[model samples]
Target: MIEVLVVVGPGLVADAGLLEEIAAREFAAAGVSGTLVRARDAAHVLSLLSPSSPEGVGCAVVLPGRSAEVRSLIGRDLGAVVWVDVERADGVTAAAGATHLHGRGIGGLAWGIRHAVHRVRHPSRRIAYGPLPEQWGELYLPGADELYLSDADGPPVVMLIHGGYWRSIWAADIMGPLCADLAGRGLAVWNLEYRRPDLHGWDATTADVAAGLAALATAHGSDALPSGADGAAAPDLTRVAVVGHSAGAQLALRAVADAVAGEAAAADGAQAAEEDARAAAGEAPAVDGVRVAVSLAGVLDLVEGDRRWVGTGAVGAALGGRAPEGQAAPPYGDASPLLRLPLRARQLVVQGAADDLDLVDFGRRYARAAERAGDEVTYLEMPGDHFDVINPATPIWQATAQAITQALAAGPTSRG
Candidate 1:
């Protein structure tokens, strides 16, 4: 008779009972005769898998949960037994499957398994940026904290925006390792920290990002020179690019639009108030003048916020209830990149084929909108979920880095 072993990671001894139940159910359903064996820890599991064991156990099912230490132990001994992982989050099982498990019927299961694998592989990075010794007016900068690899400095600065439905609890620190990997490639990285809902409301968070960008630029002396090509006398500001994931992507686009609008309003206000000229002008306002924008698994359409894909209250919070609707959308269009696509920025959007949040359709919509508006937009559909793009070891991460490198190498233009 074939035998199966269930190895529970340390601290999850209680899950052994549940693993037994699952194994029994799955094995009976699949017409496989197997007995479940529980291991106290990863080492115990490895010891049991040795050739010295009773010779009948066919495969080992390792339920390490999120413990990377345990997973590493099992991976080293994978050749000895057919390794399987049972992922658990918050004491609830997330997925169970073999290491090489694949099939159309198990796509969702596979995605969950991949997400767990990614967590084990990449891990998080930690970093801190200040509530500076000098405050910016009454704001009392809260000193942003994030996870990023140290020593990220290249010709171009790439900013990675993490998506936590725009909530503060999910900071950019989650993407720290990925930032570090990019930094390892000699890319200057600004893993930003901004006010989120827990700290401040949506509008405040939005303004905080603008302030943060300004502060970052000031700190790096990016504003000292006029706009010009990369490697020119232009202070290397030309190659700056923003890579935003999920809600962060929406925010990046809005930042660009807001920057343009602020400039247009200020420049025009200073001129003679030519009502007819202003009314007849067809040019769109630009914000922050972002040269290139990339969105990974982004929620781009705010009008569809109430839809099951985008989620409602969160989008409302992000826009401060000021998002435009119907014909009104065009007037306040600067708040969304979809509405602001007329601005000629080089844009790239990547979405996961199995994204559980916002779905890949959201990224597709934004890409189509940008392309229709005459912007150069590249949309890459990778195989993974919403969080997979930030996985340091994944091919999606490499593709993102390459895209940024290519965009930065293209130099800068005043238009986007």
Candidate 2:
């Protein structure tokens, strides 16, 4: 029901024949039954992209030059703009300030087209958790009429945090398919988008995650979400789950630990210590309604990750500094989930058998450490690579989703 403009830049910048071929393949795979228009140049493309353009074109797949006019065409409301660069030119399209896929060569173009089609079919309501541009999340809910009229308290909410080693080039669009899949299964999904440490610093990234979680928990009764064809509703916080991938897994666990600590600090002195002790003994801590937390091919142990120089020292960059020489200190103590053991929520740690060996080690060791700290944990090690866990079509994700569904169905675990 959407029109896609595959703009082939004049010159050797793009392969016109390959562009058309990929577009055809992707459109067919997406089951869009939509129209694809090939434009010879940028001007030709722009003319066809108008609101009154023929056949109602709503999105573009562009292979562009480094010109200002080309970059300015990004981030428009015209569905989605996906910029393609086969030579892996770093961060160019991302710096254009748009929701796009770039730098993966031909694969990027194919995924971008699929992403564009997905957006048109499953529209999400954008809700801002803070005033900043990066402080927002896309909420996807079951759009059925019965869902709106049902008196029952809505579906369980799932908060998804994406990962690209905390870099700006990788945005929440990476989680698009997973979000749509979960929403289709009748779960309200909040796909969180936050400031990356590379551009906004580590503190900002962590703070944004915390604020986004808080906003998700409180959105139900407030005027924070706007209603329309998207039908954005406050998420069902009574049963909430946080699902984070890669570096985002660390963020998810850290947020839960922070929430547990805050709740303990606010209680009566002796009672708070008693509750903390109980929580550390595998009992549910007195915190908000977050029941389960899942980590997919996660970077769980910052201390070890830093020591091993994981992600080419991305751990240190995310924390804003390298780990101290002798004893791991400061940021690692506060930010690392391994250091903050016995999080109040039940934990689900999933890792690909063939992923970075370091991540497999992290997942295994962290699950054991969490168990020793009296936290309930379910660890699933499957056959696949790093990206397989995020791809909705993969068996790994199917198993992960099954685990999550079973956990949610079990309801809140009774305190031991």
Candidate 3:
């Protein structure tokens, strides 16, 4: 049977007969027999699913500002244009928001009217790296609030880690307009806000992102960065970079593989017998440095993203439950950042191509296992889904800010 589907937003187009009553109760609850049609957007539902338009038995397209043309027909359509954000939750979750299947499209509608017109035209600057309250984060840009905003110390430090699958029902202000479009490009945006793996599982969201990245590397080793409006010079945390999406790109690729396995355990001396028993049963803190990272359509193989329509299982609801059956070690080996491997850091792995079916082959299986354990992987492959690389009105957010300036001008090459 031929399949063609497209479902955009504004509450699925103010109700076009509830998209043929949800494709006739999903083919009568799978007894299998399809027929549902409606197209006034997504380019009139891709000229009726191309290959010479006229196929039947599988088409459900609802329209309405098709959120800036569903990323050029999501991965050449086989299915995966499910966006329905209508501005994030409140009262019926913002009138039914979070149907979330943007497979790679989570930002559009003029990137949410350019981050609510830059939060009422520039308003941010709360900083605290740690000392809890989710170890504080926000710093977004565009003259943060004016006092000498951008003459230097900005561009470099992306950080950002928003993806709801880890639940607490999604936060980090859904990457506040991609952190105000990377702090209006002078780039120095943190946007963290942790703790939601159901209160205290996965060690309270990996120790609040390792105490807000060890209070942002002890305030970038005491240069105390954080300023924008009128007087800049704040970001550039020694050239840091991390960008995450879906499940915060599996916690920024397992905290950049535990900070490149804690700098190979302090240059191969002691640590690592499971990091001295997860630091004598505590979990994540010394927050080492991350070279570069990004994951977007993430979920990098957490045992095939723990079931129930991906992210609905959200990797066993963020590793706090599922384990028993013949359990021969199923606890997501080091919490599945592609089973921890080759992490000198320099990964990209953007991915999209209509992102569901559990993150459309997770950036080609984590760039073929971080390029077979040598790590300096790139693997871009764009075209929207999984919230279109955090939707800055997609072009996959300028190909993910030019792959984070080519992972900050590439350094450590890997592929032993």
Candidate 4:
């Protein structure tokens, strides 16, 4: 029996009563009992989780702003923390080891509680690939027998890259539902939280994605992702898919291209030597190991996006300047997924016909360009919006999921 604790922040007392009601309903639905505690600050919450406290809290549902307060208790056998309404500084809270739920407002509490229960039952791990606070990913593993979506080797691994037009305010939490859904379907889910371009420079964002995928490739036998629960086999990294939504599609496609290029360079000793020299000069290495890349209503063309002032100029802001005129140059040349075609890896490009005209246009063009460049591409353009593709319950996402499953089943094709 797990004892859940719902902690309300002092500043959020107005919603305390509603929080209690929702907690009760959620607890009942989860078949768990909980205690709602009104705390003044982090110190008060800490005192409640202390050994001297009467209530044994196995899973905690914490409010925003105070999530960092319980950071010290993480990985200390204190229990899992589900931080709700996360934003901005919440990235640190997530890095501190709490499962964060953002942007859903009061509705996020429902998912937060669900996440806490999953953590207590399945026991996911948040492993950091880099020393920075934002360079970490949470691995969610499903029961072995529950793998309805698995192949002969094992469950396919899917790394989710969330997108908020590459803004810092949009962390990995937005991908929570999708992560949970994929895991429930028996796919190992890696929900990554990276340093966004807004606060940590564009290069940092791209570097973190590459490094995160590299970590996933070796996660099977490493401490980064252990066989969960009953020692179920780790996910088959050899058959991996990178799924990105909205702006994340850009990162996903770019990473695939970089990896393919990296592999080719590695095979050529002279090219590898040059790349090593470039690495010594501080250029980060490209990462490999992804078999398929899925883009959901992705902002795939940086030049077009910047030209359209999409996301109110989010593309330029993320790439650090307007699209280079005459010829693609600098950030746009390397950062734009459309500019880096023939990604080599199989691609599933999904776009909503009703999404922003720019995104739909970009998806259509990118898919055509990729196919022209001799890459395997499946273009699925349906009726939906930007976010409909992310919602698991939506028809758009169901079709996208089926496409991803098919792509992963096909396995990796030789780039040569």
Candidate 5:
């Protein structure tokens, strides 16, 4: 028994009875039985939408009269009841001799409701594969990060880090589709959620990731293993490959650099100072003994980022406000994968040609830098925007999937 509630705006109050009659007919046509509730204003609309109602509608159709009010109501009841906004026509004709709804009307309103309903019922599908048992937990791991685990028995375990300029608003759920894809390919996937720089700052997020990886390795009995290709013999840690999107790519690169720097510092008895410096800089020391790192539209060059318009907001947001004027370029330059290239592990960078945010130049620059540093870097450019790379329906996403699958199948290789 699907139920829908239509909230008419004040402007339509004069013809409220007529509009309600039209909506009732439309609902019957859509195979949904519902009642049209006329509200005096946006406030009255909210009152009707409160959780106290017993009918508990499955969806709500709102005309665009009070858009802000509609949005607020939807925000409060998301996942509980679907919301759709209707556009009205102002009597403007298009080439087809039909009036278009730019701003009052039943046609646009009905269309929006139907579209929303379809989306709610038919979300993207994901398949899970591998032998690892599913595990779920929330822990205050390294850098005081919140971690959620989904484990399976597979040859290689993949870690997915979402990109949001390292902002807190983004979560592991953003990578859900991607993780599902990797898992379906018979790989154990870990979807990691870390503290955003906005909440705990950059260092904390990095610490959380480092800790989470360490926890993952320890749980799988791979912590004591030696470094190198042969290290794949260790328990569930056969081969560690990280897939990071956007700023997550920056985090992944920093993780690798910190690993190398940690070893160097430890060997020279400079570990404490190094740790202090890392803390001050809002960065983690890095994960030790990773085999491969794949970055998707990674923002490697902060200086380049500043020069360009794409990711400046993200960088500024993550860095706790714009870098001070003439402050030696804020650690973003040093942290960029381009500057740290000649990376120890084999690297693959996949970028979208239509990605307006990161742009193609960033990936090209990183590739050039890697080659100059004698690092083995494979760059794959495909058509589509930033989000399309993870969207299964897009060809670019399929290409990325193939690249990852091939890399995993080939195992780790030496660039030198």
Candidate 6:
């Protein structure tokens, strides 16, 4: 009998036990079955896999969105691990690392049902922008719009990062109408879809965010994609800002902070000699490009949100219960925009007082903290609900547009 370790990252956790039952069948069919243990994050799974032995577990079944982490596992039985992926059907396919688990047995079947319902309820014609199948963004609008920026080589791209509390259950596809609105208004839009915490965790989600942004940046510079299929304009990443809602707001802020942290450190080396020494020491110059964050009712202060809503456990789910240590690198500190302050670019936070009380507090508190940290922070408190801010038909979206316009006018800066 083979011991099967069903590593339930963030994705399978969303399946609500359906995938567990399916996995049992898969293992039974393969004549490998003993104990079906459930593991949370990769760290926990690795710990249980036996520190003394490399191939401890008979076989490990990793769920979706964990391809990156699973690929990174060290000293594991390469041939015994199976990655759970979903394409057309649910069956175990061949993969370079371990084994590939594919087919409808995937939790995507459940997602398909819900996604279908959502697609119907929220009608949108936004396209998915990606060369890879997993990496897709809801097309709000492409590079060129009916009306380009009044002053620029081309319209700036407004990458839309939707918020579902960083959960896989909440997809970027739900932000269709909002993307359409932005694209319709002469803005290039890329509604990014990332692997939520379900399959892997925050690490995967954050990595996807970086990859999606890079893909767009590459696409912008590539001559291959001159225009959209409809012959619309191509996005210009040289002048780009992120318009993120709720949890996505926090991510956008973090990206800006991470991208500019090096520059901020270099700025401390005020003396030319020190700067020259650092450069001689193989230090890179601060990246200069279009950078700004437009947050819509975002949960910027995760530390505060976790404390207030301790019962709900939303923050724990996003950060894997890794509490902030006042000053640390990842798992928590990197996740919190409040801690990653002193950003070089401007941040326009359009918060709604009528939203969740914790989220509201996050917006207000984050704005104050940003100001204290010398970031160009603009906090706007409007009379709207959480989701209302993303609606183009509403006045709140107009405020978002205004913020974007200002950021575009200000243009790019090398303050990082």
User: How high is each candidate's TM-score?
Assistant: 0.56, 0.85, 0.31, 0.82, 0.58, 0.63
**Local distance difference test, each candidate:** 0.54, 0.75, 0.60, 0.78, 0.58, 0.62
Rate residue 267 of model 2 by lDDT.
58
Give the clash count for model 3.
28
lDDT of 2 by residue, 1-416 (tens): 66776665545366667767888888788766455555556576677667687756676666655555655666445445666655444444343233555556666778777767677778887787777767789988775452422335666778899998887666788889998888776677889998888878887888788878878655667666433224544455777789999999998888878766666565546666765764564333333777788999999989889889999999998888988876668788888888888886699999999999999999999999989988989999999999999988899999998888677666784333
**Model 6 regions more than 4 Å off:** 1-133, 139-145, 150-152, 228-233, 262-288, 322-329, 414-416
> Which wins on TM-score, candidate 4 or candidate 5?
4
Best candidate, lDDT: 4
How high is the lDDT of residue 296 in model 3?
Answer: 83
lDDT order of candidates, top first:
4, 2, 6, 3, 5, 1
- Report the C-alpha lDDT of model 5 over 186-234, residue by residue, as the tens digit: 4556666666677567666666666556545555543332211222222
**Model 4 alpha-carbon drift over 4 Å, by segment:** 1-5, 13-37, 40-44, 47-58, 64-78, 84-96, 99-122, 148-152, 218-221, 228-231, 274-288
Per-model RMSD to reference: 13.5, 5.5, 18.8, 3.9, 12.3, 13.0
Show where candidate 3 strays beyond 4 Å. Answer: 1-158, 166-173, 177-187, 190-231, 239-246, 260-262, 269-312, 316-331, 336-416
TM-score rank order = 2, 4, 6, 5, 1, 3
TM-score of 1: 0.56
The segments of candidate 1 whose C-alpha lies over 4 angstroms from its true place after superposition are: 1-154, 222-235, 262-289, 309-313, 320-325, 328-332, 414-416
> What would the per-residue lDDT of candidate 3 be over residues 54-89, giving only the tens digit for each residue?
655143333333455643444343332232343342
**Top of the candidates by TM-score:** 2
> Number of clashes in every candidate structure?
12, 0, 28, 0, 8, 18
